[model samples]
Target: MFSERRERLRERCSGAGVDAALVSAPANVRWLTGVPGAEALLLERDRALIAVAHPARDRDEAIEELVVPPGQDPAVAVATAAHAELLGVEEHDLTVARHRAVTDAAHCRLRDLHHAVEQLRVVKDDQELACLRIAAEIADQALGELLESILVGRSERHLAMELERRMVDHGADGPAFPVRVGAGDHSGRARHLPGDRRVEEGDFLTVSLGACYRGYRSSATRTFVVGLAPQDWQVELHGIVFAAQRAARETLAVGTSLDDCARAAGRVLEARGYPPELDEGVGHGVGLDVEEEPRPGALEPWPGEFGKLENRVPVTVGLGVALPGRGGVRIEDTLVVRPSEDGGPELLTITTKELLAL
Candidate 1:
């Protein structure tokens, strides 16, 4: 798998007028070679060479490495060692100082490796998908365990900590991101930080979390009502967000434009009198990085730049709106974009979307 990735990256480098690529981005380095750590530089040649300033554990020994001297730049060492003439460098990732040092040391014409590795990593192979599926399952188990516990009087921070511990117990390397617990008026606010706010009766509760397994990450979030039954407003808000999320998920056909999918959900909230200004476009790509490419609200590269959905790519369809001083609802799921012939998009984080009243 790593060899295939390196070959494809080299092919791209050749097309971009370069014979060699100096990949300094950690994530890109991992994609090209299995080693994961900082300050590792990759030089693509007849064989890829990794230069590490410090020791990094390599279980597979799949790629060769050059350990750098105390003060020598790894990028310069790798690039110069490869004797590259025209070389591709991660323009966005490499600092200006590093690029200049590499340019001076290697004396090579540097071509921008414009997010090449990210483009490659965006689509998941079957093994990657299997890992992500396990990631989702771990998160689901953690959240499921949290749901089964007593909830009255617990602080958001405690719940958040408990969820993270549960994910680890269920076999995640760690939480994909920080576990978010929001209550009452804080419920549904996107990316709310857990605090001393305690769970109380008649409060809306939201929990957003994910688990990472074998370097793959998946995200899932849910909001539920506290106590015997949810108040009317809680039910109404949950239903609106639920409908919006469903609209977005239903739009997840292979090859469909992502812009249409974002619009589908946004249009629903708009019709229901949800504030249009709070519209953060539906969702994003998920894998090695929790939020990678295909993020709807981020930059659009070109005309019709909104990317088309692809099979085997996993993404999170998260949508929520918060009215200040009032609790909100956020519903998210990590799903693989598969064709309907394959039973539509396979929902990986399935923990019942129905708004639950505890």
Candidate 2:
């Protein structure tokens, strides 16, 4: 599997007229090679070298290993190994200091790879999709268990920690991102940092969390009323957000543009009194990283502004709407984009999006 990815990368390098490529981003390193150490990858026409500080801990069986001499920087060691006439580097990720060091160490002209690894990671293979599916399942299971427990007096931080623990207990490597549990007025925000706020009766509660299974991650978010029943406004807001999320998910398809997804969700929110600025439209690509490609496009019209959706690409459709002091609603799910001939988009997070009354 790793070999295939490397070959594709090499093909890209050849097409770009680059003799070799040096990778430094952790996610890119992890994707190309299974081991995600403080390492660098040097890929040539027919050979690959992974320079790390600890050779004994090497977990990537797909490439050769070169341990940096004690005190020598792995980045320099790996960068100097590329002897191609033109070498490619992930300029977006490499720091200026490191870039200078790499330039000094290089024997060839350096060129920006321009997010090549990230571009290649935009689609999902069966193995990657499987890991993402397991990640979503773990996150769903964790949230489900939390809902069944006593939540009236739980602090947001406590709930957040509990959710993280549950994901780990469910066999996840760890939480994909911080487990966020927001109560009171903070509920429904895209990413509310869990605080000391304690759950109170009738308060809105929003839980946003994900699990990392292997190298893949998936996100899930759900909002609920803390009391035995929800207020009329809560119900109304929940319905609106739910509709927005559904519209975004339904709009996802192979060959669909990200703007199509954004416009569909934004229209629903706009029709129902949501400010255009607040319409942070739902959906983003997910894989080795919880949030990867297919983000919102640039303000100015340009090529690749809004990425086009593709089959086997996993993304999340999450919507948030809130009223200060009245709480708000947020619902999200991870799904895979697929063609209609084979099937519609496959929803990975099966947790009910219905507003629950805890």
Candidate 3:
């Protein structure tokens, strides 16, 4: 599968008018090469030369097919010895100092690969989709276990930590992003840092998290009421956010524009008298990185200059209502964009969205 991915990358590089491309981004490297070790691929139209760091005995044996011995600057060594011209590199990831070294070693004009490699990664293959599926399942398992435990008085930070640990225990490479557990005033804030704020009666406890499996990531969020009885406003806000999220998720398909999906949800919020926070977009593409590409929003141009939603592309649909002074609500889910014939969007995160009053 990975060999095929590398071949696709080589074809993409050639089509982009570059003689050769030096993939330096960790995610890009992992995408092209199955070996998770620090490695670089010098891709040309005719051939691809991969250079991986010297590994321990176990890793060395495990990745013998891709290992490039130690004491060798893979990019520099390959560029110099290969006699390749017009080398392309990821300018966004390589620092000025690193770029200088690569250029100093290369005897040709160096150009920026920029988002070319990333653009190639926008559409996922079966292996990538499988990894994301497991990632979402791990997150769902963690969140499900959390719901089964006491949630009346635990600090938000502790809950977040426990969720992360559980994900790791359940076979995740790690937490895709920092676990967010916002309580009371902090609820509804996207990406809220976990804090010492304790869960209290009548308070809204919003938790957003994801787990990384292999190199793919999945994100999910759920808002819960932390008491026996809930405020009427809490119930109403949660329902609004939930409906908006569902609407957005339903809009995901192969040819659907990102702006259309975002607007579908944002308009729902706007109609409810809630000011839309469209800046974050409805969601973003997810794969090797937590947030990858093709952000959905109103300002994003149509026909997506970045890329379009292709079949098997994984993304997160998150929408929230943050009522000032009053606690808010947010609900999100990780889903894969599929052709309408395949039942449309395939949801990876399966935790129930019902507002749970604990």
Q: Which candidate wins on lDDT?
A: 2
Q: Give the TM-score of candidate 1.
A: 0.92
TM-score of each: 0.92, 0.94, 0.90
Better of 1 and 3 by lDDT: 1
**lDDT of candidate 1 at residue 215, scale 0 to 100:** 80
Model 3, stretches more than 4 Å misplaced? 45-47, 56-82, 297-306
lDDT of 3 by residue, 1-358 (tens): 6667767776766776777888888888788766677567676666666676655344422222345567766666656544567888889888897788789888788888767767778888887889999999999999999989988789999999999999999999999998999999999988689888888888998999999999788999889888787788988898889888888888888888667787888888888877777677878889999888766544333343744688988888888888787779888898999999989999999998988887
Clashing pairs in model 1, backbone N/Cα/C closer than 3 A: none
Clash count per candidate: 0, 0, 0
Quote the positional error of residue 127 for candidate 2 in Å: 0.6
Put down candidate 1 lDDT per residue, 1-358, tens digits, no spaces.
8888888988888888788888887667876776765355555557778887666665446567787887877777777776677888888888999889888877768888888788888788988999999999999999998898888799999999999999999999899999999998898888799999999998889999999898888899899888998878888888898998899899998888556778888889899998655356778889888887776645543344458888888988988877789878889999999999999999999898898988
Off by over 4 Å in 2: 56-62, 69-72, 299-306
TM-score of 2: 0.94
Local distance difference test values of all predictions, in order = 0.83, 0.85, 0.81
Predicted candidate 1, C-alpha RMSD: 2.3
Per-residue lDDT of model 2, residues 290-315, tens digit only: 88886656521235545878899898
